[model samples]
Structure formats: C-alpha cells, structure tokens
Target chain A: MTEAIQNVANPQIEVKDLNLWYGDKQALKNVSIQIPKNSVTAFIGPSGCGKSTFIRCLNRMNDLIKSCRIEGEVSIEGKDIYGPGVDVVDLRKQVGMVFQKPNPFPMSIYDNIAYGPRIHGVNKKDLEGVVEHALRSAALWDEISDRIRSPAFSLSGGQQQRLCIARTMAVKPEIILFDEPCSALDPISTAKIEELIMNLKKDYTIVIVTHNMQQAARISDHTAFFLMGELIEFGKTRQIFENPGEKSTEDYITGRFG
Target chain B: MGLNAKTSERIAFAFLTLAALTVAGFVLFILYYIVSNGYNAISIEFLTEMPRKMMTEGGIYPAIVGTIYLIIGSMLVALPMGILAAIYLTEYAGQNRTTWAIEMAINNLAGTPSVVFGLFGLAMFVKYLGFGPSLLSASLTLGLLIIPVIIRSSEEALLAVPPEYREASLALGISKWQTIRHVVLPASIPGIVTGSILSIGRVAGETAPILLTGAAYFLPRLPDSVYSQFMALPYHLFVLATAGTNIAQTRPLQYGTALVLLMIVLAVNFVAVLVRRYYRQKLKI
Candidate 1:
C-alpha cells in the first residue's frame, strides 16, 4: 500500500481537497478525485449537489462568478493550475468547455468554428483546414458543409450544439469539460451528443456533469456520484450502477433518491 | 364582473392607443409645419451654394459640411471609449462598491445638461487646452456630453448578450479580450450603433453646446481645419431666427435650416436602422 502511494502514476487531472464558496455560502466541500486520461468521467448529482461546480473548477470557469472563492489544489497533468506562475489563458487552452445551452456565436458557421484558432494566432492559411477538421470531428461537417458562410443561428438546436462542440474542438484542448451539454437538447440530439462524447474520449479527457443517471451509465467509463457537495462514490460506471459500495450512490442510481 | 373586466380592458386599450397616437400626431404636426414653411426656400442652389450677405441669401452648405465633420469627430472620440468602458464594466468589474459608484457616475453624467457640458468645454478644452473657439473644442465637448449615453447604451447592449455566449467562448480556452471582441461586440454592435446615431442626432441639433464652445455666427468658407471656428446648422438656425440683423427676413431661412438639420438627423437614423437590419439578418438573430 505504501509502495502504491509512493509510485502512483498521475492522472490527467487530480483535484485534492477542492473547496469553493460563493460569498459566505459553501458550494463545494473537500472534493478530491482523479480523472484518468482519454476517458469519459461523468459527474452525476441532483441539482445544487456541486457536480457542475466541481466540473467548472477543473477549468476555473467559476472565476467568472463575482463572489466565487476557490481553495485547494487542481492539477492538470500533475501541474498545479492555481499556482502563481500558471498562465490562466494557457491553462484554459488545455481545458476546453462546452455549455449546457447551445451558444453559437452570432456569426457565420465558418467564423464560429474559426474563432478560437484565430484568437490563438492560427494564420488564415491554416484556419480553413482547422475549421473543417473541427466540424468533421464534431459530426457536423456533412450537414453544414454547404452553409459554411451562413449564419450559425440558422441551424436547428441540435446542429447549433454540434457547432458549439466544433468551436470548442478548434482550440485542440487536451481536456473538455461539459456542463450539462445535452440538458437543453431533444432526446435525439441528446443521443447524438452522447455518441459524440463516447467517440471523443479516445483522443481527449472528457468530464461531464449530468442529471441523467442512465446517461452516466451508458457513456461514461468512470462515474462519480455527488450528494450535497460531497462525492459519495467514484468507480467504474458499471460498478457504481450495478453494485455501488455506498447506499447513497445505489439510491441515486436506482432513482430512489438523488 | 366579466363586463367590468371587459370595460376596464377596453379603456386601457383606448388610453394606450391614444398615448401612442399622440406621439405620432406631434411628430406629424412638426414635420408638416417645418416642411410647409421651408419647402419654398429650398432649391438646388440653396443646398449647394454658400451663404451671401448677412447670412440671409444663400445656402447652408458650409453649415451642413461643418455639422457632418462635428458628428464624425465626436463619434471618433466617444465610440471607442464608451464601448471599452462598457466592456470593462460588464465583463471584468466585480460587483463591488467601486463598480457601483462608477455606474452611478455614468448615469449622472448622462443626465447632465448639454449647456453645462458646453460651459465645461469652454473652461477646459477652449481655455485650458488653448484650442480656442474651434471645431476641436466643440466636438470634444459634444463627445464628453454623449460619452455617458454611449456607455449606458453599450453597457445595456453588452449585458443583453446572453451569458451563455461568454461562457461558451471562455470554455474554449479563449482569453477574455478575445471573447469580448469576437462574441460580445459583434452581438452588441447594432445596439451600440443605434446609441451612436441617437448621439449624432442630438449633437447635430444642439445649439447650447456649440454656442459657447465653437459655432460661429457666420463663417464665410469651410473650416480650414479643426482649429477654425465653423458655422453649424443649429447655431446657424439660431442666428437666422434670433440673432441675425434681419431676423424677420431670415424667418424662411430659419425654417429651411431647421428642415435641413431634421433631414440630416433623419438620414442618420435611417442609416442606423439599415445597419441594424443588415446585421440582424447576417447574424440571423
């Protein structure tokens, strides 16, 4: 056991004693978890259980909230992200995010996909290929190929979400954080996004916060069930669902409680 | 009870309709009065030729040109500062007492009278900066007067851009400045442009701001430069109606000048509407 602790290989992201507060109200309390590389880890909880808040900590998205104060260490690739010397821009570059609602920028389809790369100093010569590659990876290239110059808002909700995914993919982040990405989509769109996530984990570390128990069971390799700002259990999705070691995790999975 | 509800609803509808029509009626009345009195005075030569004699006989071409210059000049000063301030307030500033104080100051500044701004300009730009009674002084004054309007309008526009968009961009590992430039500004440009057009219209028609700062009673030629005092439509109209040697004789000229100023403002508003429509279409919002 001592040898195991001494020589454990670092996970892609390791969060230790992560705590967050919005003004006086604590939102996350002592959350410690290790997310393996090239795997989908689903954060499952009911509303206000800190699942989303915990996921947001991975990329420092909570910094946008005026009252949010974070404590403890969040390391990506074994480097402390909250350390003084860490460049937040570079940290964010390695940790992309997708939002709950589809928020395609008010621009053409091509411009939407090209926005991230262009800002990161990708020249115009390479942008065309980058945009195309991102779109294809997000499974939207075939549908939006002809309407590349058309406004992004012209697409359906499903297509718009896909475009948003493509936009995030353009930055080529190693880890992609999804904050209820399919919460606003139709079931068909939700299914498509699920499939996309499953396929994406082959190349990128994916963290998803979801309310859907079945979704976490279906797609995620690893599952972490949260209850009232505490992680109840963390293990293989199958183990957590079929034979959870914790009663709370079993209750949440069986829909008896959240 | 049903009959009472219906009666009250009908009365409310009537009041709302009357209120809306009253506004439209006043606008129509003003347009009719100006156009009727001014139409005979307007001609191709009147629009093209420079004024002759004691500001009574010829065109307001110089005033028209000067007004355009002032509008463009003021916009150049106000637009960038206002937009940047708004972005900082909405995107970066924490919800603290300092941010609240700055917001309150902007609101108060917007409420400050144009004439007060004119006096401030006289004391500051004209006297202290040594610009004298010139276009530079007047434009800078007008720009100061409208900065609050730009800031308020752009702030509202920036706020109206859904937080979802900002979050989505930030999640992509894009920097804050990049997100604002690419997402927030593009989404909010139409609103900013509308505010700018409103400011331009107000600046074009304002007599009080230019009275002390820069407008000339009559300048023979176009302003040689920003340093030169220039004729402006509002001040020219003021001169024609009240200060000219033959105020009665130049009554038609007053109406004509008023009509021209109104036309210029309307043209600006029309362009604003077109630009807004074009972006709305392009963005498919």
Candidate 2:
C-alpha cells in the first residue's frame, strides 16, 4: 500500500524525472523508470520517440553529442551518476553499450575484445582467458576461433556485431544498453543477438531500445511503451502486449498506431 | 559548326589533358635545365667536401647539414604542438567562441608571409631573447612558420578518422585521452606522418625566414652548436647566384646547389610516400 510509483523492490537503475534537451528542443520529458537487477527491459516506440535518447542516458553516451543538456537524476546502485563527483569514464565502466551499427576497432579480433580489459589494467596473463570467455558469452567463439588473429573487418556483418557485443562484455559492466542493435541486422543475426541478450541478463541488467514489438515481446521480461517523449505504460511484457492500460500503448502494440 | 555532346566532350578532354601536361611539362623543363647544367659539378667531393676559396669551390656539405639540422629542429617543436592542438580542437573544445577564434587565428597565420615570420623571429628570438643570429633563432622562426600547416594537416587527419572509433572506445569506458592514444592517433598516423614529412620540403627551400634569423652562407665548419651560425642550401644558392664577387663564375655552383636542394626535397617526399604505404599496410586501412 505504501510502495513507490512504478517501483521495483530493488532496482539496479532508478531514473527520476529525467529530462533532456538538445538546444531548444526537449527530447525526453519527465521520464521516470526503475529497472530491476539481472533482468531484460525493452524500450519500444516509433522512430525518434526518445527511447534511444533515454537508453543513451544510462551510460552518459549522450555526453558525446554537442548541445545535449540533461537534468534530474539517474542513479545506479544507489549512486547518482549525474552528480558532480561522478566521472563519466568510471560510470561507463559499470554500464556498457552496443551501437546499432557494428563498429569493431581497426584491429585483430583478439585485440578488439582485449582492448577494454587492457585499458582497465587487467593483467596481461589473464587477458587470453578473458577474451575467450567474452567471445564465448557473445556466442561468437566457435565460428571464428580459427581466425582470432585476423582483422575484425574480415568477419561477416552478423559476426562483426557479435564481436562488438563481445568487446562490450570484456569490460564486465553491471548493465548493458542496446540501441536498436538488430535494426541493421538480418533476421538470423537478429535472432542470434536476441538469444545472446536473453542469456546475458543472468549476469548483466539489460536495457534495449527496439522498433520491433515482437522483439520486445519475445525477449524482455518487462516492457516500457513510449509515445513521443513520455512513458505511457510500464509493466510485464505479457500484460502490455495482451492488455495495455493506456490507449496509445494498446494502439502501438496492436499495430493500430505508433 | 555547332558542337554536339560527344564532340564537345572530346574538346574538353583535350583541354584538360593539355592543362595537366602543361603543368607537368614545366616541372620537367625546369628539372632538365637544372640537371643538365649541374651534372658536371656532381662528384663525391662536391656533395661531401667543404666549400673553399671566395664562394666558388669544394662542396655545399655544410649548407646541406645546416638545412637538415633546421628541418630536424623545427619538426621537434612543431610535431607535438600540432598533434596536441589538433586533438584539443577535435575532442575537447566545444563549439564556443574560444575554439572559433583559435581556428581563425590558425588559418590566418598560415596565410601570413614567411618574411613577416622572419621579421617576428628577428624581433622575438634573435633580439628580445638574445639568442643572436644563430641556428637556434632560425629553427624557432621556421618552426613557427610551418606550425599552421602542421596543425591544419593534422586536423584533417584527425577528422578523417571515423568518429565511430571514438564513440566505440568511449562507450567501452575508456577515457578521452586513452581513446585518442589507442585508437584515433594510431589510425591517423599515416596521414600525419605524410603531411609532416612533405612540409619538410617547404622547410628546406625557405630563404627569407633564415635570412633574418640565422643563415650565414659562408660558415666554414658545421654549426658547433644550436646557438652558432649555419649555412643552408637556399641561402648558399642565394649568395652564389646574387651576392659575392664571383657571381658569374659561380653560376655553375648555383645550378648545382639548386639541383641538390631540389633533390633533397624530392628525397624527403619519397620517404614520406614510403612511410605512408608501410603504415597503411600495417593498419590494413
């Protein structure tokens, strides 16, 4: 009876009244959501609906964009990430991100995965084991183990995407954000990424912004439907898909509107 | 007769080919003229031995060494500063008034005449700093003159590196400087090295900047130190062709010196091309 609004008993990430603006245009308006630990939460909306913008806020990736100003609170593990003392680099160490486009470093396959660990001062001796484990987790080790020394560009597009995923996993972040990761991927590749993401939630809290409603339904434990910049419904995926409370949410899920 | 597309295209192609060939033709003509006149002076002693008599003997070796020294010295100062400035502009500086002003200043500085830089060097390094008319003063002045180009070429190289690389590194929790060191700079190395080396050609051939700051055209020995006066190819050629008592007698020496200077510049540029290719292969870009 006295629970907080849209509350999770223990949220790994808690964002409160988060607002964002690019110059004069407000991109995110009063977005408040609590993402539970070790679970998959999918952000679904039409193009430019602020889902991507909101996910970028998790790792402070939006900081790279000039004129992007943020306000309110984004707390991870009870610590406010936007606070004055917080270093963006340290914050990103705990929150990894995968881009829509596959961007492997212009390096060998092993170096791509080893890059993060090497920078974070992981021992050189442990690096081989770490790379193997990360690649195995991303479901890519079996296909390309023979060419570990090959340039990352030698891989197929889907394999490259997985390599990027492995690269992110190498850092061992607490949370992973996927921004339309499958949008550029073919169906088979998308399925593979979906399965990998589903498996990853056991160790990492996963947040994904997706245009495909079925993808959100297929993999996510919880779903947040966004219309324009506002969160319309936040609930279990089954409820949101089968019977959404908000009209806009119902319309979006049923293909009546976006 | 009215021209059709095909006929007009042929005429245009002819004009374009002529234009390109004309430029190449002039370069070849100059090369032929210099090499023909200077080939007689080409001997081991001419290249390696010291100059003798009243400006008409031995070798231009001291001048050659002095030019190399100036090239090395200027690059020592310019390379780090140019690369750092480029990194700051591309990575850190916001699109504020400060960055705008800095960019404008760099561009305007590039267009400022070399003689003006020479004069400034005379005032600042030679006179104010009391370095005197020496190799140190000339090197510093030439460094200032070439920095704008280095900054611009480096900025272009930095811009050519895919932004996706920067974002990828940063999202992996790497710091800005670490990302630059590991990814951006390494990727842009070929471009930076090529541009920097090619600019050395310009540094070798500059006359006025050294004229005010340091070049002596008659130093018997190698510059004893940075503060000592030195002779350079352009100034030696200047003294051979225009100054001194034996201008007509040293005409052959002028052609020889000019040929040597051109060859030095060409040799440096050839090394630049080789280095660029090697890096491109290693980076697999």
Best by TM-score: 1
Residues A1-258 of candidate 1: C-alpha lDDT, one tens digit per residue: 112212324478988888999999998888888888899999998899999889888888888887899999999887999999887788888999888889998888999999889989999999999999999999999987988998888898988989988988899999999889899999999999999999999899999999898899899988888888887778778877888887787787888875
- Local accuracy of candidate 2 as per-residue lDDT tens digits, B94-165: 888999999999999899999999999999999999999999999999998888889888888999999999
Off by over 4 Å in 1: A1-10, B1-3, B96-101
Relative to the true structure, candidate 2 has a C-alpha RMSD (angstroms) of 2.5
**B1-285 per-residue lDDT for model 1 (tens digits):** 256988989999999999999999999999999999998888888888799998879899999999988998899889999999998998889878999999999989988988999999999999999999999999999998899999989988999888888887887777888888888898898888888888988889888988999999888799999999998999998788777989888889889888999999999889889999888777677
Candidate No. with top DockQ: 1
Clashing residue pairs in candidate 2 (N, C-alpha, C atoms within 3 angstroms): none
> For candidate 2, what is the DockQ?
0.76
Q: Model 2 chain B — which ten-residue stretch has the worst lDDT?
A: B241-250
